[model samples]
Target: MTLLALKNISLRFGGPPLLDGVNFAIERGERVCLLGRNGEGKSTLMRIVTGQQQADDGDVMRSQGLRIAEMPQDVPKGLSGTVREVIASGGGKVGAALAEYHHLLHENPDDLDRLGSLQQILDTQNGWALDARIDALVAKLDLPADTDFNALSGGLKRRALLGRALALEPELLLLDEPTNHLDLDSIAWIENFLADWDGALLFITHDRSFLRRLATRIAELDRGQLTSWPGDYDNYLRRREERLHAEAQEVALFDKKLAQEEAWIRKGIEARRTRDMGRVKRLYEMREQYAQRRNLQGTAQFTVQDAERSGKLVAEAKNLSYAAGGKTIARNFSTTVLRGDKIGIIGPNGVGKTTLLRLLLGQLHADSGEVRTGSNLEIAWFDQLRSTLDERKTVWENIAGGKEYVELGGARKHVMSYLQEFLFTPDRARSPTHVLSGGERSRLLLAQLFSQPANLLVLDEPTNDLDVETLDLLEELIVDFAGTVLVVSHDRAFLNNVVMRTLAFEGDGRIGEYIGGYDDWLRQRPVATARPAAGTKPKPAAVPVVATAPASKSPLDSKQKRELAELPGKIEKLEAEQEALGLKLATLYASDPGKAVETQKALSAIEQTLATAYARWESLESLRDA
Candidate 1:
């Protein structure tokens, strides 16, 4: 059954429409992942579906009596009372009765008369079954029913909100960035839960692992259009790439033909003499089409400014022990980090992953034993809280630090140009940091982190709120970084792709050392009796493995070396040609409009060739450096 459908949806605030004549539909038992960059109006589309907002011009079709519920990207405010009260709110009036009855029974057990009154209300309203169901849900989610909802951690708060959404018994559930702040364990549990869900689901997320696990179909919102791909994320990626390539080819061909016709019409005297008015009218229509085209957003270019290489040994912890809040974070934990090693730290949220990082970095005092810091370590830390960013400051000010130029790779680059590399426009760069979205904030922090030179990078939850493309770029940068990295993250795919070794934080302050990433540690670590339920404490046993040092890099072959040496000049020549073509195109547009299209085609070809050359150069450079 089709739960909902949108047709010819168009919405705009200013400038171009965000959703231009968009069409989408969801049927029963379908789990769809909504993919897009930040500020793409995904949440607005959800609002349209739920009748919270209306499209400027379109139709939102829904099956009669369809119940839709949404778990918003950020928690809604002004919610008070116990977890049960908050969840029961989803049930409407009957839920209110149940919440009051439960609170009365728990807070005043001896008040028989009041409890009896509420019980009678529940009985009359046929809410006893719902009461029982609520209890079951609380247990199933491992939530503390009596605890204040406002007191829960971010992850637990999200879980409670999810339970509330579930309580509505919605036919269609919408979740926005459901795994935004969750630990890996919670993420896995939710993935499994959603896999068995009966109703249709539409969600937005940046976690590739979660997307792959739960999304049966992918819906991408790009350049003011929504496209649905029938299959998994991997399939969508392959098909989308092919589709873009084909679209580019079609566009190139159209431009070429348009240019030829334009050149024909530029011969004003000959054309007037021939009296071919149809061709001139066709040229006007083509001009309209070309003018209305929306170009794809530019991809973010990242470059990490590297510091001088540190000592071969980065840090060594021997019999390291630390405790906070009467809980042992690390008990006799020890590890050695060498140059060029990428180490990942994995554990539950609030399990002292950051504490361990501080201990290793000599920022926190150990209760016993010691940590020996290596000589000349230039450290750059990516803080999860984004505390490093000043909310009052503009984006450019935060990055430039009041300077007009930033030293990147030991070269002085203009601050605005550098910011542009990270995809921040002049207006956006001038806006206060506080006004940026989560994804934009992540990008700004990255810009700040990479602006300075560092040989040792310590990242805490760096993957949170970052789009997948930016995440992929960050992964490539880390893998290519010729330095030691100690990162704390719960992104499974990120850990798998970037880390060469893993450190697992098991119960009883036992941190285990294993080779490879999250999956690798899971294979080698001691098996547990069972995975813990949501909101339940986990007791993971440590299993240590000795890590091997990375092998020495091999010399590049003669052919590869020659290609690497020639790439820079080749790239420069292509860029020069591209610039000249662009200049010609502009001049033709003003002086001879007919010739501009041909110049544009040439410019596009040069740009494509330059991109390919640059990619090849980077690949060979990484190989040579390795």
Candidate 2:
């Protein structure tokens, strides 16, 4: 069933429309991920959907009895209650009204009929079971039961808010950048939770892996229009690449056609000259047509210069440790940086990844060990704060400040040309730094970083505000960079694509160096009861067995006897129930539209059961028999 629908939606912020004639419908149990570059009205659209903002021209139709719970990027103030109280308050006004009604009922039972009616209403709404649901949500969000909401850290507070949002159990959930402040483990937990969630979810996030695992469809908001793709994030990316390639090919064909027409027009004009005015007019018209056709092709170019190399050992940290508020953020961390090494530093929140970067750059002093720098090591540090750029200065000045020669390739080149490479147009390059969006600022910083030659690059959360296109450009630059790099980023996709090595800082002040990309590190890391098989003895159960007296009856034959005996029963029972549930779900979708909201829940339960049965069946079927 359609849970929410927006028709001809138009929103404006005193100027141009942020969203123009946008039409979209979200169905029950559908997990749709919204993608767009920063400052492209993604957050504004979310606000409109949640009723916090009204569209200038459009209609928002929500299904009757549908409840929407939104988790905004910024946490609102006035929530001064304890964590438990805040979580329990997700029932909203209903919970408050029920509590007051219950108190009155307990005090005066003389009006038994009225009190009983109120009790029935509360019971029907499951008001009494809300606490249990809240507890479960809190546990799932990894929040401590006794922690106070007011005293929680930013990350913890965000998790608490998420818990409250989930506890509401609304028919539709709107989340904006839910994975931004979360660690890897928390992100994984959220992915799993959303995978199992029954209600419809519409979220905006840059985490590619999260989108790939959770999203069933992708809604991309670009140039004030929303387009839907019928696949996960990865599939959407693949399809987008093909679309771009097709667009490029079409533009090329148009250019070739225009050139041919122009050549014909030029010949016609030259041959006719002063003899025929009609021929001249026809040639001019043809030129105009070619000009119009040429305008159809978009003009934007991104190019990075080849980086100049420096000597080896760009920077080195030996037993680096930092203390803040009488607690060690990192301890005994050591890593060497080669001339061409692209190292990524990642860890949970508050794990001192940034601190380690600061230590390497000598911005922060280590409590224990020393930092060594190579000869002629010129470092270009892109701090997460981005405090280097003066907000009051225009983009032009920010880019060209203190530089002797701002021209590149003698095209009257200024900061504008450099900014253009990062997708900032000439007009935008003249805008004040304070007026730029987060993504624009990030690109500007990158442009500035690349303007001058540097042997070493230290970037902290460089991908934080960058769009996918800009990130792609940055990745290409990093791959081609001849300088050493030490990057601190939570972006798994970026790290995997750009970095060759990883320096993982675990929360307990221990850092581990892993060769290869993020995926390789994950594969080598300990997961559940499974550890990396590095010089370890195999368990007795895992060891292979050989029978000495198996001349008449082979060992393989004996094992096969046990497997065939168990295979049929396992397959029969699982297949029977799987078919039943599949039919039941199909019927539900066909009959009651409201049942669509519960489909994901039912499907998850079915999947769990089927997976278990399938695993057992595979194990039984794999054994050899006599």
TM-score of each: 0.82, 0.72
> Which tens-of-lDDT digit does each residue in 1-626 have in candidate 2?
78888888998775446788887878877998998877779988998898899998989989998889877776788875567666665678655545445446556768778777767876787876875676677666767755568888767777887877876789999988887666666776677778877999999887777778889768888767776665457657876677668967987886687676556555655564644566557657756766544222122244333345666767788888778877677788888888889999887777777777777767787889998867776778887778888999888788788453365433445556566666776778778899987777877887777666677888888876566666776788789877788888777888899999998865567778888777877876554423323222445565666867655433445665576576677667766764565445433432443563465456556567767867765654544332
Worst 10 residues of 2 by lDDT: 294-303
- Model 1 agreement with the true structure over 136-230: per-residue lDDT tens digits: 77887778988999999888888888888888788999999998878877887788788888999999998999999998668888978987765
RMSD of each: 14.0, 9.1
Per-residue lDDT, model 1, residue 165, is 86
Evaluate candidate 2 by giving its C-alpha RMSD to the native, one decimal. 9.1
Model 2 clash pairs are 557-625, 557-626, 559-624, 559-625, 560-624, 560-625, 561-625, 561-626
User: Model-by-model lDDT, in order?
Assistant: 0.85, 0.72
